[model samples]
Target: MSTRAMLFACWIVTFGMVAATVACAPAPVPVDERRPDPGTVVGSPRRLASYPALYTSTSRAERVEYSSRGPAGEPTVVSGALLVPRGEPPPDGWPIVSYAHAGDGGDPACAPSLSPDLRGALDELLGLVSRGYVVVATDYQRSSARGPHPYLDVASSSANLVDAARAAVASVPGASNRWFAVGVSQGGHAAWAANERATDSELRLLGSVSLAPQLDMTDVATDAARGSLSPERVVLFPTLVDGASSTDPSVVPDNLYRGTLSRRTDAAAPCLGDSGAVGTDDARAVPAADYAPATDEDRVRLTAALDARRLPRSPATAPALVAFGGRDSVTSPERTRAAVRAACARGDRVTVLERPDDDHRVGISPEVLDWITALRSGATPRPTCGPEPTSPTSTGPE
Candidate 1:
């Protein structure tokens, strides 16, 4: 080879080697002097798979949408809002509280709305967040495009709530693994259900709070049958009956003559939301006792389920705070007390508080507030229930 060609080849080899060395070199360490603030690290923005595109606005609090893997390859998407403190992040993993709303599948669109009349109850969400705890509220199954809310599908909804919390921690900055689950009315049922079924490895659930929970469907239906019940309560019974019957066929009468069975079966099918041709108003007009399967048969089935105690059987490994209104006619406090006792027997750290004067709609009472404060401060709450005097109160509609 010519001397010039040999020299050029050598130079090319050297350049290639240098390029490779530079490419493989470790990156310079970030300046220690500019290390990220601990608070910032805790509050940094994060993304997780299955989370919906986050929505933020000057007038409204930020919102997130996300999906979770469900049983049997069924993936369900849930939408929720993450309420952070106004200016700074909490020092430790911020305590988290997940709020489950009550009744007829709440509307997710109202999550960030500012109007008090609408879903914009920023105070509730922001209150906890401002107090150094992240607040997450899910739209659950029905709130989004996801159909088949499965309103009473205790296991499914509970799982969705848990998965949403996990997703929130992944997506929100400075979120902590410690969490509390709370719900009122229908939501109260959800809180209890989630606690019963939650796994230790999946959530470090610090506590669960249930307010005026609908504990025994059988009791509620019986009350409605004996007298004039609220249209809402009356309408909800059939759905519960249908769900229970679907899960356990024995809940329905086996010896009912074929004609009677057909009539009752037809009435129960098509679920509340999916009852096509029959309008919501029409469905609501049907009295609980007037349904096809004789009221006695329906009652028999529901009573059996309650006697069998088919509620989520998983024991709550974390502490639980159960509150009920003394005057809650919608859901019997007696039943709630029984549930609290059961939770205690299951070895859960349990606290039961009954506000003698409060009704179903009043938000948390002073005693309940004190209990929450104590829990957040790391005090282990003990179960307590009694007839305390009613206090003045106001809470938004369920």
Candidate 2:
């Protein structure tokens, strides 16, 4: 076995021993207020088939099954990764970066922990881990659970993101409870929502970095149902319908797709880059128009779910750095800007990064890193909300 694999084995055995000892020891009648809860680790972090090879700066990268609350407030298990830096941690422990990845279809196989490649946000995560920040990325319950992935359900996914941090602190030897959230696209919405949800957890949320978050899915879902969704975003229709089906029984494959596309066994078959039902394969070929709801009631049911998941569900729990691209077809720029405005109006300190020429794929750069570094150094971020053409900290196209 490799050294990393051996280390993982040792951690599992040691953790098991500690757990057994704690279980056997007598406990006080009352809970101890002075001691902070170390959070919940559902199972020991095990060695993944692929580990640190993708993250050169990481000394240890392992897959962990962590505890989280589901949509209806029930206990659930989710999958995630814990990436430790290359050297010894600071006295307080290594500060954490809880990452939320974009939608990768509803399939468990699309999970980042299962794949060797980080995908989409590799460079950003690589930079942070290289700079000594421990990183944890949640696959959300949908990726690891028994049902279709709730594509944009911020509440549940954000809980998973924050709980991933809790699990890291409970499981990783030197992982600090101090943490921040970072995400892109769907993940961006998750990160922003996690910022609000983190206040309830034991972990300290310093801030969040959100890139191209899909704030209000209601408009987009409505567009898809009405056959008015922009061509650029039509590829996402299947996933949206699948996600809507996860929450509402009324929305199904047969009523949402045409002919063979509706006949496919796997309703949620598209895996991010693959155009499952929206492509030109004769077996299941169809135009974007074919992907439509059977009735107006189906559209209403889908829209209701999307509306409930809108961002700023409550005022943000921490200051944030939100970057929005003008040309983002997947997430409406107008809606994102509106959400940010609403958050600002609600007394949240949000620093905006408006890149007018960029698209849905916003590049992570040094500026974003500098902002995170400033927060770590105890610098207060200046809020950027004043006028219509808001003055953002970073206005240049990225």
Candidate 3:
């Protein structure tokens, strides 16, 4: 794994929230019964627990625990927030944006649905929604489910996001079919996954915008074993392992935390920063080499799972705009550039946004806002590829 992958796995330190979670054994959820469409809402959307949403004084806010399913065919209830712009619709109704959030590790409280200040962590959503777009973000399954969240379970995260948008269209007044996605960090990965999968769903996804996404899990895991993982990162290992194992049980047939990093893993249950309460000494104590998967079976499973998580698959049907900080410690900018090249090689209509001065929290810049506007207006965004002094297309205000 490159330095960025190590930084990416350890990006949990970037978030400013408390962690709270309990380990859960990987279990088989019932096969997700097929709906008419992958993004179909499971049942009636309940508006009882609505929170103070963006535009509430102007628009409206509501928290709904909607019924949605996973790609595996298991039935589940996912929590999320939906905000509709106040005032009259624009004839055809409001153009919607399915917002995917950054990965906040395993803490359920950090999930936007349960967040006390929903608009703060994701101020970007407020920016877009205030401009007349209906925004919906999912809290993901593991946060509210019986088990640990499968951090990068591509199918589940993608499903959670797509269904949230689908629910918005059904429950929000004047919502249109012209929907797209914008996500950062873990969410950036989900946005990309949704784009790959959305074409087959009932919803019409025009495109997606991803910022500093967690693209290569293999790179991340490799660095962890090298003992290169930071103190903040080591604490997050359990969730990554647990999530991956849940997605592919063969990866860790046995309990991963029953051994050395037990308390550190347990401490990771809550949000970031505080996750260190379990201490950084344990992470420093054992070298990643010592705990390398011993058996051939373990090696095979690890290899396969990593291969599955690499980004830039071929034949993408929609437009994608991806951005990452030039010096991002979390996920490498080089990886983003590589994915851009791979996407181009695969016939994907993609664009690259490189920020020389940014880091893990890639604030949505002005260039990004303009890119979104261009996409909304049907203008093909130009790819600012190639190395050198190209900076984030947009930053802060115009």
Candidate 4:
């Protein structure tokens, strides 16, 4: 071949190699389930009880198996426990508080059913029950069962939570229909989503209390890339992104699951245990920025899906009591404010509280206590530093 011809051949070979690499790479997953549509319904709510505890210990915690009509189900079963104070059986059925938890390693093997630690969180659940409130908690659809737990599939997740609350009221002995929702991190995200999507008529949702909710995955991912986030969050972000992207067709499976991303892919399997074990290395190897989508189309679609799957829209219908740690490095307070503002604009009542000294985990209890106090008084809870001055204010008079 002549020199020019040889050069041309080399260029073709290089192009082929690059194309092959691209073709083999995995793309992000898109959501396959229908996004939440808008509508509101009010219906007569009923209550019944069933057994959810297999172990004697769980049985002692006021645990019950409850069901509700949700999405496409005969009845979705959720496990919940009522923690009413020693003597008070809760007058007028007591108010219901539902909790949506953060990612629980997404493995069925390591589900709350199997993990001692998760079961321990039940202590908190039972604590709320003890406070003369019906406490409803869901393992979320995918995480509880050994199936695809759509990590951020807000609609389905919210549906499961709402159904679980309905079940808890009927299943728990002294429970009533007056309800509120609360969650931390992943659970907070679920609570937020459920609040937005819940049918107004189905359940009398008073308000939602969220602690350190992971409202913006993209923002969290960006912070993780900058080394400003925790190691656990860095690891968790990709798993969520991958899980959420799995429903989209434009996202190539291989590209979505390739390289460092694949290391944490197994984290979504719902096997009961520490997901950190499987994803530790991947967490260490990649930076958050590197994990973001490269193309504009990919970014746009991923962001749209994330926004669509978020729970901000529900703030309009119910009052929201949201708290975040000022020192929170995992889920930024600024982003949380943005989400709160969006929800408020939709006509939902919202309150955003910030604890300047708290980190992701420690600052939650105080907020919860404050929320309980506000709800009991029948007054809207106010944000600590006043309204997020940069964001929108609550429509309910300050």
On lDDT, the leading prediction is 2
For candidate 2, lDDT tens digit of each residue in 265-359?
A: 25344456655544423423345557677787777877787787788878887778898789887888999989998998887888888889998
> Candidate 3 lDDT, tens digit per residue, 275-304?
444345655775665445555556557657
Worst 10 residues of 4 by lDDT: 1-10
What's the distance in Å from true for residue 385, model 2?
A: 2.6
Q: Compared to the true structure, candidate 4 yields what TM-score? A: 0.69
List candidate 4 segments past 4 Å from native.
1-88, 143-147, 200-202, 220-230, 267-282, 287-297, 382-398
lDDT at residue 103 of model 3 (Cα atoms): 60
Query: In lDDT terms, how accurate is model 1?
Result: 0.51
TM-score per candidate: 0.64, 0.81, 0.78, 0.69
In model 2, residue pairs whose N, Cα or C atoms come closer than 3 Å (at least 3 residues apart or on different chains), thus clashing, are none
Instruction: Give residue 205's lDDT in candidate 1 (0 to 100).
Output: 79
| lDDT, residue 351, model 3 | 71
What's model 2's lDDT at 268?
41
Query: After superposing candidate 1, which stretches have Cα over 4 Å from the reference?
Result: 1-60, 69-73, 105-121, 143-147, 200-202, 221-232, 238-312, 385-398
Task: Assess candidate 2 and give its lDDT.
Answer: 0.68
User: How accurate locally, in lDDT, is each candidate?
Assistant: 0.51, 0.68, 0.63, 0.53
